[model samples]
Target: MDIAAIKEQLPIREVLQHYNLYPDKQNRLRCPFHDDSTPSLQVYYKTQTAYCFSSNCATHGKSMDVIDFIMYLEKCSKHEAIEKAKTLIGGDNQLQRLTRQAVLTKMFSYFKNAVYNSKPAQEYLQARCIDYRQTEVGYNAGQFHHGTRKDEALIKSCIEHGLLNDVGNKSRTGDTAYNVFGKWCIVFALKDSSNHVSGLYFRSTLNNQDQRHFYLKDRSGLYPKYPATDTKKLILTESIIDAATLLQIPAIASQYSVLALYGTNGFTQEHQAAIQSLTQLEEIIFWLNADQPGAEATSKHAIALQSLYTKARISCVKMPQGEDINSMAQAHDNMDVFIDLLEQRTADFSFSIEKENNNAGEQQEKAKLFIERGAPKQPTKTPPPITTGELDSTNPYKLRYERDTVNYYIQGGLPKTTDNMKIMLVIEDKASTQKARNRIDLYEDKQVEKLCKEAGEKLSLPAATLQADLYRLTDLLEQLIEKQLQQARPPEQALPVLTAKEREALQQFASKPKLIKRLNELLGKAGIVGEERNRIFLLIIAISHKTADTLHALIQG
Candidate 1:
């Protein structure tokens, strides 16, 4: 049998995808034979050849055929790797199907339940303007460890079902799942072209957005799409939540089919096959995130799929810069903004890949055609915390903004549109006391005034208007933060770590009760109280080998 003939039958692009590898602008992958972050490996689309260019790599700047990649990844002899490659000739392997079924039945259930029971989870959805009832997405109560014995057991069960790694009980120790999915997250279900749920996707709600998304360990290239949709128009976005948001809009309901890629960088051969299967499709609209990566991915996807769907008109809808469909929908409270984005397109900027040079030249042409359209304009509303980089950072102070979307439900007296308001929280240590304690004094009058002043200036509001909104927002934050403070702990994570000198000072004061009492009084005078002040006092006591003056200086530092 001809090895070349067998290799020719394999779709090299798809094969690379199995290892979660994708081509960059140059149609190149990171060499699998080395620890490479950059695209050190080049895959020539025209010649159907690949090579690792990094001279230091194990591949040693040598060229390779697809079979060599199979051998490298599978850790098998050339003939064995060839035989193994033959079995992957079809789509959605057996393990992928079995694990997907198990995860769907078990993992999705936990998250779907979490939507109703968890406050942070619910707040996260509300903040995105997503009513849990409006979508099929799943939620996880971010405080998975702190919950009851039942919660711990449920998470462990995920390991049993192969939803998580086979690391046993360690998967419950907060690091295992959080390492893969991030602190707290919501899971989105992925479906096949037939629209059957076959995999789970995760998006962190606890500000770990960089960890962004995760797939079932055994993903079968099954993605999520509304199976009921075949409206001749399909909108593709970066996430399932965005897709669900589009479908929820009355103006958009049933008008177009919607689906989400895992993200801008995420694409697979199965997705390409699904796109190719749409002979009846008349339009494919790209509705990606309003960021640089999203735009580039949209351009590439549109250009690639356009060739396969020759009969369809492919266009990319513009999300306002820094605003995704979730934020855009929440801002407009309807489909007007989405329709605006779709209507803004004037031409087919798709690039045709010339047969002569299918690598750099084709990509450069694609970029050239797409970039000519110009950048997305700045959005009108206050961008989400995730977009502004506020939520993504470590908020040791637990500083964040909370909003009360006043009109979530359409009751007899309520309007259909949600009255979304943004309120800034001003609490240095509200973590230890969100409830049962008076918190109004914790917020300074000047601080509240300053926040309102900024908001008013940004929106060009009259003083009187600002005052009225300010009163509402202040009262809302007071109520919201006060309620949540009940659940807040001492915030041990927020306290600063002691330096070597500080440790020495603390060691000196450890044996002196009188010194500890005096330092506590000094800390109180400095306006530090509660858990933070106590922690500082303890730090001094633990390292009492230094004098009181030294300890005091260390504390001040």
Candidate 2:
């Protein structure tokens, strides 16, 4: 069989599954060629290609057709890769041909008309800064059309087209999947190379997490087409909304053809075919989320596209650290910086995908220990005392850490108060140089024991309890601090201090027997006695009794 025939026949997703090179819910994977802590490989099922977005790895931007995958995975020559793939694919099943394309187009047209007339869907696009009229937006009449509100014509047409699974609409009675058929949802038509409506995607206008995007089984793995008028530049985004937003930009609209992957993981063989069709396309830039996964994807896709289109320049336009393209577009003040960055062909910094990170390894171990020790059983607002460097309260370990500082971890559960148990993990350097693996306890290791005592004191919890369960103790302490923070006024707007003259004027009231009596009582509440409490009492009195002659005189003074 010809190599191209085999490539066409082999279901890349199945082949990837066969090799245990799988994508997650987000359709990301660690590049097999690199020791990636984060998944960097994006497998485009429709495109039948995989790209390692890890720029630091040798395979960075390396675009692999199924044959390239075989070449890389088997470390074989072209002929060998083809031969090995032949064994892997066996007799591969072909993609299910979409038979009702014409029907789908008609339904999409009706839905698109519905969306154009629907006030809410129009507002939804307007709110997203998308011009529905100009952008070819449609509506998905989600779980709303029922009883008298049902569009029988649409339903009958869909049934006629065999577009829906259940013929009589009996499934809509209660079947979760089938019941959703006639519901109103916003529709977006995905186009193929010939500008034919190859797919219809339905996205809910409301904030429903579970039902974000609804695609018919036949339409799966297709990219939403955007015009590639300037074949020299192509911009790929993670979502249709983002793609639409990018196209609205004057610079982007004039100089680029844009495509949306529908999802982070939705790049398909069909999209790859469309990309191959971009004969004059020289640059393919990824505009994805600026997160760990996004960064990895940007790198993976960039590398893949560069290799796939060796003649084309492949680079990434980095989104501002925490902003997505939509948010960035909305920020009128930030457009210049964003546009400047997007105009560039290379990234300032792409994370190291191939480097073996000891910190990541240690954090993974600590997370294992945290979970094993029953984190859920003793839940805390503050995380476990795990450190992956940086004081991000977001990390699993809530332990405070300074770069290159010595931090200790205990083995087993909690040790007795000052029992001086052995330390299992020791973080010596901040960015790197993390060391951990069980070691014997030294009886003379008083320093770690002392740290425990200090922690107990700082936490205001009994030493025994704090030592017994670090996670629970931290939780209690964090809860208390959170409560206090909630009650306390912000420091910037704290009550004003009295001047020296006011203090002297208020000194006269200090001699009052009732004042002295109350001041002494407050000493107990304040956890102080004698001079310190006396001064605090005077200040308190001055703050509250501003109308008193002595206090007012003190304030005036």
Candidate 3:
């Protein structure tokens, strides 16, 4: 885990709220570390930091961020505090249950009753050729109530889950606490691999075209709820209506399992996890819309599915232009067209092979052109991606930043990202030809120090030099990180040129008695004066703001 990133993203306000402490209107709160008559701790929201001014406080005058505050409140170490912060931020992979199971069961039951009673909802389902009789579905009349006094726990759970909205309002009891889904909307239960309802998805039956679909907050579920492990074929669709249509068809429903994505870009991690559990799966057919977005999604999802299930045949059925499965089904009134489309289904492998062949032909043409230009044709040797100075060099303890390792021989040198900087630390005893290996994170000082100490006792090199070289290598890594951030910026722009008047104004400002005067003195000693010096001074100031704090400034100007 990157502790720095956690500290950066977790807010101090969240930490205080977690502890049941609220800050007053002035953003001042009583310091919990010591007894106080009034609010004394100041919360700096901009910096996500808090400090207590009360002298009697144990944490007085200490700038406590979320992580530091967690440590103090939990009475735990920094590492423990960081782990707790991760849980609080929901950063880790553990899937958090958003609502209670009982509440959802009761809510689904209510919605089911609403579905059965509403004539418009049944007609809407019939119009779409959706046979939801065998499947779990619901309808929202926008009049859901969380029950009476005996079910207070369930009511509170409903409120927390957002199934019951606008509580404690002045509206009548029947008018209050409406579900997010407005009147005449169909609700579908989405489930995890274990067949447990994890979330709710809704389709608006109203005439609001812009707001046709809605899902519960933090929706983390997939439609159809479950696919048996023995199922060998899986068909993926773009929407629940399309999937439901296919499921209503006896031929497709018996032969294959149908799953629907929320939309083009709505393939969640939960969907991937569910697919991964299908050990018997052999084919994944993307039956999305025939539009550009659907085509793009098919290619994208096919590639991802290919990576996950390499042996599974990845194919796509091309629908008629601008027509999805539901529309096609509605137009044909049968499965004949769909069956023909399935028969004409194209495999992604053919496209991939054709692409590679075209690329190869293009490369050959380029090579022919190069030869025709009289450029010397010679076989070139490529370096083995990475090299270690400590391993291959005669000076085993060489302090080369780019290719250096201290006492440890890295298998993959260093990770490019700071989050994955853990490396395998290997040391060898030349006398016995024996080796010792341990994995350690370079960012963790304690781990590096321990590795160095062990290496010193095991190898002929000194531990201090080894530790110093590792530190120096990390410094170079900071410099090397520009390559990672370079792509994040647009094409670099040329330095802005200052006008004569602007230059004169800058010079006059820098010549005044302050920190800027030091820059002016340095430029004066170099005998560089006028517009060029002003540009250099401005450039120095701009760059220094990125790396230096208020107390420190780069004095190169």
- In TM-score terms, which candidate is top? 1
Which candidate comes out best when scored by lDDT? 3
* lDDT of residue 454 for candidate 3: 84
TM-score of 1: 0.45
| Residue 511, model 3, lDDT | 75
Model 2's TM-score against the true structure: 0.42
Native-to-model Cα distance after best TM-score fit, residue 110 in candidate 3, in Å: 2.2
> Any idea what lDDT model 1 has?
0.57
Q: Residues 1-557, candidate 1, lDDT per residue (tens digit)? A: 46877666565654665565655424566777888877788876545668888987877766677777788777789889888777755434323433334435344544665676778878888877777776766776545434332233345545554454444344555544422243367777676654445677777776653656666666754434533434587777787778777877776665777766767866677666666666568887888887899878887787777667777877777643556777555544335656655667534555643435465655333233443345564565853444321221123212332222111111011111223322212321123322111112213566446644564454444445434544554454455445456555465667689999999987887667787567777777787777665576666766665766544434444
Once model 2 is optimally superposed onto the true structure by TM-score, how far is the C-alpha of residue 517 displaced, in angstroms? Answer: 99
lDDT of 3 at 89: 71
TM-score of each: 0.45, 0.42, 0.44
lDDT of 2 by residue, 107-140 (tens): 5644655664688888888767677766776776
Task: Tell me the lDDT of model 1 at 126.
Answer: 81
lDDT of 1 at 96: 43
Pairs of residues at least 3 apart in sequence or in different chains that clash in candidate 3: none
Model 1 poorest ten-residue lDDT run:
406-415
Worst 10 residues of 2 by lDDT: 365-374
C-alpha lDDT of candidate 3 relative to the true structure: 0.67
